[model samples]
Target: MGISAAGRAEFDQCRLIDQVLNRLGNAMAINRLIIAEGKDSTAVAAASDSLAEQNESYRRTKRQRAKAGCDGWQRD
Candidate 1:
């Protein structure tokens, strides 16, 4: 999106901040899911995967994971 070097740097910095905030929010949501769903790995994994799909960073960096192609947590 940014053309100039300084502009790109600023954009990256802001993007990093957004990513951090998004992860924090995801963590909170998963924490609540755990509290609600109990110690069920399957459900938690599914919820986390769903959250990852909704996250900009995860969607940008792990497109394959989004499609459940990787060996990581994925739904059937």
Candidate 2:
């Protein structure tokens, strides 16, 4: 069996929308972490750890947005 053209288009559009939403969610989470951790070193360190975990989670997302297609991974 094969997908119809319209079905394939819908799948692609859905995938793109999902990617955008995930990126937005990641950005919002990072922003909240920054705001909540703005005062203390301990909180900053904990946020650093949290960001590190998020970096791993969003590694592919970053690569997709990178200009050179490299992973372009970073700690911050």
Candidate 3:
């Protein structure tokens, strides 16, 4: 059976949410490792910070999207 238009939209939204969440999770893991190891290199620290920012941005964007009517995804 083919999916309805609404169902397809929901699936796409869910997929995008999943991808963003997975990226955030991976970034968090890497950030944790960097902090745990007590790394002091400028490049490493900068990269970690960038990852954190990106993760937060993704989260905020997801929230905005949800608030705008894409309610097919759930937060962890």
**Highest TM-score model number:** 3
Mind giving the per-residue lDDT tens digits that candidate 3 earns over 27-75? 7777777767766777568767877787778778778667655664546
Better of 1 and 2 by lDDT: 2
Q: Give one digit per residue, the lDDT tens place, for model 2 in 3-75.
A: 8997677567656755764875776587567757688777677777766666666665555545332333445
Using lDDT, rank the candidates from best to worst. 3, 2, 1
lDDT of candidate model 3 versus the reference: 0.74
Which candidate should be chosen as best, given lDDT against the real structure?
3
Error of 2 at 51 (Å): 16
| TM-score of every candidate relative to the true structure | 0.41, 0.50, 0.63
For all candidates, what are the clash counts? 0, 0, 0
| lDDT assessment of candidate 1 | 0.59
RMSD of each: 11.9, 9.8, 4.7
lDDT of 2 at 64: 54
- Model 1 Cα lDDT, one tens digit per residue, 16-73: 6556656757775775677477688887777666665556554454553333333234
Q: Could you tell me which 10 consecutive residues in candidate 1 have the lowest summed lDDT?
A: 65-74
